[model samples]
Target: MASNRPAESTSFAPSGTQTIGFASRTDEGPWEEWNPTEDSVRPVRGRHRVTKQRGGGLARSSTVLGVGVMAAVGAGGMATAQTGKPPVSISLPDLSSVTDSAKALIGEEQASAPKGSATVLSTAGVSTTEAAAGTKNAGEALRARIMQQAESQQDRIAAEAAKAAEAAAAKKAAAAAAKAQDAARTKAAAEKKAAEAEARKKAEAARLAELAKQFALPTSSYTLTSRFGDAGAMWSSGYHTGLDFAAPTGTLIKAVHSGTITQAGWAGSYGYRTVLTLDDGTELWFCHQSSISVTVGQKVSTGDVIGRVGATGNVTGPHLHLEVHPNGGATGIDPMAWLQSKGLNP
Candidate 1:
């Protein structure tokens, strides 16, 4: 069988005055205590050496250093936590911070983010600078549109008003021209009528002067017995209204002027009278004629025989009673004065 006892009396000394001996349980009595010399202890330094400590070792020191580094990192992370700052930030594509400079470069990465991230960015609140720019641009566009419309409307209205004014002026001018033409026409017509009236008046005056020269006395030899308007018992209207020429019967009675014979026959109380009418409305009566020589409407020359002289028109003697009337009135004027106006002395 194999023994399991220890060997006896192996001694090793460390440093001064301290010695340790090793023995088995069956070793003899009277052990010796030895002292170590001064040359036994030496400083040693090398790689891959095992150092011995009393209780604590290198594992404890390494654990203490790791705990201190973790505490410092936790404090730094806590300090920036309010601002959402990360610890040890790196340039990893998916985990990068949202910086102002990096946000402009998000086009390529926008598709990789969540589906609604692009929508959130697009609908974000506008800054004061962006809002002011948009307002200025919109106001300029609105003002341009309004000004264009107002200018177009103003031009149209002005053109219409000008056209209306021109039409009114044309109408007024036409009315004035028509009035002038009408006035000229009226003046011409009035002048024409006045000229015709003057010519007719001159011709009538010439004809009247010629007729006055042709009239002559009714008898060559006679005596004026009664004058015109002699109030005596020989008149029916209370007056002798005509001149009585007392002449012998069967004497050649001549027509006073170139006139038509209106009557050459016997009248009541006037035996064989003849009435002659001239163109100037004068009437001559030769009454109590012995014989008639002309009929009605027979034209006779001056001193032409119309009837033989006798008594006529309420006469009493067998004598020629010659009377003259200017306008066939019942009253008569003095034959002597009327003959003198015709350049004849009765």
Candidate 2:
């Protein structure tokens, strides 16, 4: 078995007093107790020589302690494997002491290092600070760009909306203008139609007025007793075929127009009658007259006294019956209408 005690020193030492430097034994003094210290010991040479180190020798001591701990853990593991035994727990020294020693060594190493190496470390720190500032500036720039883009998009949208509104307003205005134009055209057409109608009416009046100058009433101071187509038992036909003008006896009758007398002194039921033929071959008949003043085949002008009004054959009072025949036909038309055509109201 290996002993845990330290091995005894093999160095030689004198147990009692000895002669100094080959002197006589009578000159020797009494011997005293001897104590050994570091100052009293002499340094060894070769590989065992002890050299002084800086940092109060803590660096070397700490290095030896770390190596010894690693060796001890490795030996323990080997023993456990070889002997088939459980691993023993090892008690480690305080880590704080090792840490302080390592700090002290680092401080001495930096102090002895060159200026260029220290500059490199300082430059690295500055670069780190610059990189952080650059990151922050980049973030701010990006935010600003995003805001500007958003504002531009919003402005574009607003412009488009305004453009749309303007387009709608223009369209509405165009439609309103078109509607007004249509209304104006309609009003103009109506006014044109009315003007044309009025012009035609005036032209007709002028034509009738010219005809009135060439025609005259057959008798005056008379009242209309009957009209053509009047139904009565006093006439031979079922309806009256001529217009009647009631007046006092001896009322002078006049020629209706420039015409030649065709018949006078009527016979039968007609007490007095006269027939006049115009240039157009239209015949005018004056019946129930009191007297006849014009002769047959005699030419007369308008307003010439032709006869007088009186009660004649088949007559109930002094009245003149007038008839008109176009182209001397057997049938006659209404004298009132024929007179109105000559522009004479009566």
Candidate 3:
């Protein structure tokens, strides 16, 4: 054994001062594997290396020591340059956070490891390497992305369906309410029409009952001969202008109601005619009478016999022609309707 020691030793650091060392993010494993004399340690960042030595072992040792100091001070990163074994990368945890396992490794290296030696890295498998590298297969990445997208799409579709269901329900309720409103309006209209008709009927009945006590027929023994507005050329007017009553030539023709006799005598085509005037200036003419009992301006009461029926002047037969001249107008009205207006149905 030729002095198992270095030929020389050197350091760039000042004399008798502690060189700075660095803490790394990776561990180098066991401590007994480093031997700069046989293995090359390449500089990681700047220019320096602890290369294998064939001559001047002491000087090589001194250089390796210098490189080691740089490595300890975190001179970027360091690794053995020779092959056969992979280049070893070495680091340390933060001194404040060092675990028991890391502390044991450091203690073992300081107590048993020789000078100019490095720590060797050992791994369980490729899977462990891959885990440290944060690598995943293509299939696994794709599967995770697909699962996230599927979940998102499903949530969106479910939300849309819920909104559609709610809208349909609201529409159905509105339609039902509209239909109910229409039905109510129809029912109310029908009820209003029925009520109005009933009221009119009652009013008419009451009027007729009152008029029954105030008026009487002109001739009770006569038969209906013609109606007003009858289309015939039997008179000067194409349409008959009066209501007619047929009876014996000598039948009694009474005054229709209490009134003054304005004229009583033969009056041309209205031969043996008599004109009665009411309080409101309405005129009543009785024509085709056999004889007249009252003179002009003579007052007469209702049901008083004022003339006898005859066919003296423009008459097809013995009949009394009664016409209504409202306000003594030249044009007479439909006698039947005029009588009904007074609550007398004839």
Q: Write model 2 residue lDDT over 33-126, tens digit each, in one string.
A: 5788887786533223234376574555445445434543555432123556876767655444355555555466557656555311121243
Candidate 3 lDDT over 1-346, as tens digits, reads 5777667775443334433466443333233444585235553443233334445535433443433444434633323246589756655333333234344444554465566554323222222234333434544778889999999999999999999999999999999999999999999998998988899988987887677566667886778879988888777889889999888898888887888999888789988889999888999999988888888888888788898889988987999999999999999999888788777777
Residue 88 CA error for candidate 2 (Å)? 39
TM-scores, all candidates, are: 0.37, 0.54, 0.56
Clashes of each: 3, 0, 6
TM-score of 1: 0.37
The true-versus-predicted C-alpha distance at residue 78 of model 3, in Å, is 28
Worst 10 residues of 2 by lDDT: 119-128
Superposed on all Cα atoms, the candidates' RMSDs to the truth, in angstroms, are 26.9, 19.2, 16.9
lDDT of 1 by residue, 1-346 (tens): 9988987874453233433366334334344566676665454323123232336524333333333334334445321235566666533222123233233333324454466432221123432245446667877889999999999999999999999999999999999999999999999988989989989877766765675678777776777787777788756677765666677777788887888888878877667888988878788887778789999989999989887766554677656666778877665677767765665665
- In order, the Cα lDDT scores of the candidates are 0.66, 0.79, 0.72
Model 1 residue 307 CA deviation (Å) reads 0.8
Worst 10 residues of 3 by lDDT: 120-129
Between the candidate structures 1 and 3, which one is better when assessed by lDDT? 3
